[model samples]
Target: MAVKLRPAGILLAAAGALAIAMPVLLLLPGGGGAVPRAAPVPAPIGAGTMPVLARVYERPLFGASEPVEAPADAPRLVGIVGRLNIDAVALVKASDGTTRTLAIGESVDGWSLASLAIDAAFFTRGAERVRVPLPIEPGGSEAGTEETGR
Candidate 1:
């Protein structure tokens, strides 16, 4: 009987050849040289404690201050130029002696035009209120500006 070489036999021969050649290749010049070298090492710090840590400082974003006060002489309402519905355009004589036409929500002398009535307009600053009235006219709808007690 004749023994035939199969693919399996050829692979086995190649593996054996590589196994035997590997150690011999390692012993050659570039592989495992005459003298072996050591691995790297880190340098030592000088004789002292670890370095001191730094400190950080911060400040407030929105700082608080004293509250603002209203002017000593606030605005005064003198008369109403015209009136329609519940809103009226007021002629205000300010503390500075200047006459100004003010509508509701307008600010003068640190006071705001809070509201309006048929015969008068009201100015306010915090808890303070000033009422200015329209002059009485002959044969008018209302007799005069009523004194609204607050």
Candidate 2:
């Protein structure tokens, strides 16, 4: 008779074969149009048009700063703000801390991400969020033709 298998049962069958191979090692860097997307019911970046704020704007005018410039796999800083720009995800801290979100795609100089409606009191903890109130003609604004999110 024989029965042999240990190393914590071969590392518990190699950690259950790597926990069901963790979504194939996270979709193996998705190359064929990155799978798992199916939320279509008349929505693909429209209904008003706006989307671009990968994060980094509690205050950043002209020189810009902060730990912003997300998408390093983006956990949440999916970006967009208007009322000029005030949603680093509405300072994301809900469930009790009372923060909010709804600025989908606010564009002005994002070159045409086209969406704007930001205003969580314009986030002024130390100021410098924006100001171009009717005076800007360098590239001549066409990213949504200024509804006022620039």
| Candidate that scores best on TM-score | 1
Could you tell me the lDDT of residue 75 within candidate 2? 21
TM-score of each: 0.36, 0.17
Candidate 1 Cα errors over 4 Å, as ranges: 1-72, 134-150
- Can you tell me which runs of candidate 2 are displaced by over 4 Å? 1-8, 20-24, 31-36, 43-150
Candidate 1 to truth, TM:
0.36
lDDT of 2 by residue, 1-150 (tens): 899877788988998998888867777766335677797788666746553454434446754454334322212222334435443322232224443453434322221122233421222112223221222356876346777655
Clashing residue pairs in candidate 1 are: none
Give each model's whole-structure lDDT.
0.70, 0.40
Q: Clash pairs of candidate 2?
A: 49-114, 50-105, 50-114, 50-115, 51-105, 53-79, 53-80, 82-118, 105-115, 106-115
